[model samples]
Target: MCTAYSSDCPPASSALHGGPAAPPAAVAAPVVSLREVSVVRRGRCILAVESFEAQSGEFVVVVGPNGAGKSTLLGVMNGFVRPAFFRPAFFRPGSGGPGNGRAEVLGCDMRSFGGWRVRKRVALVAQMVDVDARLPISVLETVMVGGYGRLGLWRRPGKALRELALSHLERTGIAHLAHRPFGQCSGGERQRAAIARALTQEPDILLLDEPTSALDWHAQRGILALVADIHAERRHTARPLTTVMVTHDLNALYHGGEGEARRTVPDRVVCMAEGRVTWSGPVADALDAERLTALYGTPIDIIRHGPRPVVLF
Candidate 1:
């Protein structure tokens, strides 16, 4: 079992050890790939993506306005929302509706394998929910649910699973709150707990939808820092986790106002608007003032502070 903190696992590449490598390795398929994918809800198409790919160990950020289908894109990657494709009547071998498209996550055909199977390898921390204060589950217990996906319904979580959940709670800086009622925790604390739960899954891919939204400035920064540290830590592992985060706050690309470290800058940015990808490119190229201004339909400016660009409205 390759746990999140396993150190005995082999390195991702021999290049890390400066050893003479074998012949050039074959190009691996993308961890997440979607081609001609479209999502419809209530007789309306919410997301239509021609092509989107996230390479292994890459951090990609999806940004756009409120109705740009950013969350829907993440749903497609995590197998929550099935793509709607058109299939000929003759090709429909079953009672299922006609569909046409492809959505592959972690190399599995989501449509064929089912989202439940794909979710076992993918963890999603969706937007914060308003939990009732009287909910009976503790913070730690809530996180333990993540591991239940792998542990079949008949098997109870053993001591090892408990320890694993504790370690993640500690890693996310919410160990002290482990015993607290999940609903009683502050918004930021709840977000941290949510992240801890996702990490407990030991997933190959992490999907975050507005993890830092609806929080105070302090809590927002804390979540961003935690995410950065988690990503950095996973990079040293045998299988670095691929991340896809959706946020409307452009300033989140950098950390700490103006002159602070740009620890949160993702490897790439995918800008979406009107249910379609408006632009996709490296971080530097995607943060252009003109591009963002046009995307948001609002005047925007960018000013460099040290090595990072700060987005100003």
Candidate 2:
């Protein structure tokens, strides 16, 4: 079921549709690059990255113990940290994207691109909604914040823009709550709203840090399923969006494809420990009992009974 696409993103050429299984190219350009990166705060080391790359349309799971610096890593990728030795480039480590800032994306360096342009191509959904829930803003208006990167100012969204936001809401199954106040909703509702906000940004790189940590089991699965769906659709788009998720939901080898249904199997798994990589390989292999037990300091078992991944801690 692995399909390919062309430069213009026209559903891969007709010839490539039914052709023999050609190997997937190396995908030279990385949407995110962290080179020799190290972050320290309050005399504590957070991120000590040797190297890492997030390819186009790839789903990357960052897992580790509570203090593994997962959040700090996401912040650096989104340009919140200024790493002295960090050699980062959207396409390379020093390229250009939309504006004059150099941040190469979709296979180009972002160094020639600007922050405004870079924000257009990447959207970050924080782990928690720390803002006042008591704000009077309706859900629709809240979702509209995603468009701010593109709108660039106080300009309100037009009818078409509103429709697009609603469409995103419907796709996420939160359309009915559009009129509700932000803080009055349940945690799950707010989670979906955050996702809808990211969708409204319509970005290529979706960086999420611990998105499902606060939700119930069903809501966690729903959020992961939503992310899987979005990534699947990116397969046909020009930039071919990539999702970088920082999560503790270790249902290894379980991927739900774009609200379509859970995947019979996942593409791969990546595990981190002690601010360094412990093991990274295929999802099935990475999540084997031996490896996971070591990472979490507990006995672990992955059950294969359901369509979604289930792990017993």
Candidate 3:
């Protein structure tokens, strides 16, 4: 299954070696877990037995080919990837013990938690962060929806909510564009607003789908920086917010590890292939050139650039 993206004509490791063993200290309860999970479409399994875990205040990334079920995996975590006709999504919450609710989230069964309840704990900022251009609301109001769960239905967003949303906008460095229509914002600004809206929910888990999706190099880098900054802030002061960032931008590396074997731990990378977790580990030790090439099915090289790794195929 190898392609033209291999680091050397022969890979350092075989294409199928999944990941390293879980360390002994890796016993802390995962904030989210998926076990032997599966999702079917057209009577065929699109995503099967894919699993990974994220603890409180951790950043996790999901990457795979277009149909590798990456999006489906994210949907399962947040309880969305519903079956069109045959199968159903499954998972456990980070706190639930075995057979209790391993496939749940935010202390509620994804199967039963109402929309508002889910909204309170998880906010999903999809790739398409566009608003109705004709709508007269300012950028500030647009991002305020993040507070809907807290403000509750039918209640007005009082001063506190406004401040929170505004603060997020400012933190995202887009406050000056607050009065602009959400539709008028550039790709990066829109994505930030979407993030701000999600933050308004004060969610414990932030699920971002390709925050850098269609942006250019500069835009993608900006969005990644904003996301990293946001997660760092959430870790420091937010309600133990655990962010699940779904992206294919391999440019953003982490502040973990030393030389060759030095890598990020706990905060691991989950590389998906055909709906399965093909690799998971601290970013540092997760993907060498051979692993990277196999994961992408191309002759890809993991080049050390600046403070991070860049992909060249």
Candidate 4:
């Protein structure tokens, strides 16, 4: 459910997973999990999540109204936000598979001060990153910054980092802008660079915060398609990349961006209102008109013309 400080809240992960008794034998352990999570700031509670879990290769879309703590959820998962009272656990594969259930991240307890190591394995793209118009960094260089966390203090980036960054930029359809000034790029181009930067980390889990926000409709469609392509390509590898994105883009929520009737919806949907989760299930179940209207506190109508359900106000 959402973590908003409001009267209504979405249900927790248990509502969808059914009590969470080791996640069944066939299913692998969730790569990210939070229990009794709570974050407070300035004598005010920001987020409070009872239970949240995301398995490997799962594409989760978190949708909620503004100030619902959607971005904070991703922040906590990617190790950026330190919760006031919570233990966010990560199950990483060790040689064979995700071994014994450990309440640790990157094999170290988050409370143990070595939790910074966990950040190297995760990459986060914030909703907005301000870029000065006069900044001189190239797009490729900007993306290479993602690898710096793994490189550490003394080590300098080499040819390998450049190549990796370029490859990701190409995948994100920004190879042509590799040598261009990062600050001069368009809104869509910048978002592409941000995604490429995240990919350059070779992260186990990718966190995207409103990646399509501020972009035009065409750019939004393009970016969403690019994300889908990245997910599909990674699914064939030994360790598939897991993704969690927060967005208000109805196109993404409905069918992973419009114009692709063949494209599949996200693996799961988590709807939040007032910082509390209201729905957690398949896309079909989460798109009910009444539920969405109540979540946003506005009148919403749904029209099912074909397979896709269009949301109208």
Best by TM-score: 1
Question: What is the lDDT of every predicted structure here?
Answer: 0.81, 0.68, 0.66, 0.74
lDDT of 2 by residue, 208-285 (tens): 888887788788877778777777777656667777888887762375554323653234456776666556676656
- Badly placed stretches (over 4 Å) of model 2 are 1-27, 86-117, 130-133, 252-255, 258-261, 264-266, 303-310
Q: What's the C-alpha lDDT at position 150 in model 2?
A: 81
Clashes of each: 4, 27, 16, 14
* Model 4 lDDT per residue over 1-313, tens place: 2111211222133234546565443334567766556667787666766567776668889998998889888766766676545433421134343222223332334443555667777798887667897898999999999999988799999999999999999888889999999999999999999999999998878888999888898888888887777876776466677788899975576644335522465788898765556678987777778988898889988888687777887
What are the root-mean-square deviations of the candidates from the true structure over C-alphas? 5.9, 7.4, 12.2, 10.5
Lowest lDDT 10-mer window, candidate 4? 2-11
Off by over 4 Å in 4: 1-27, 86-108, 257-263
Best of the candidates, lDDT: 1
User: Whole-model lDDT, candidate 1?
Assistant: 0.81
Ranking by TM-score: 1, 4, 2, 3
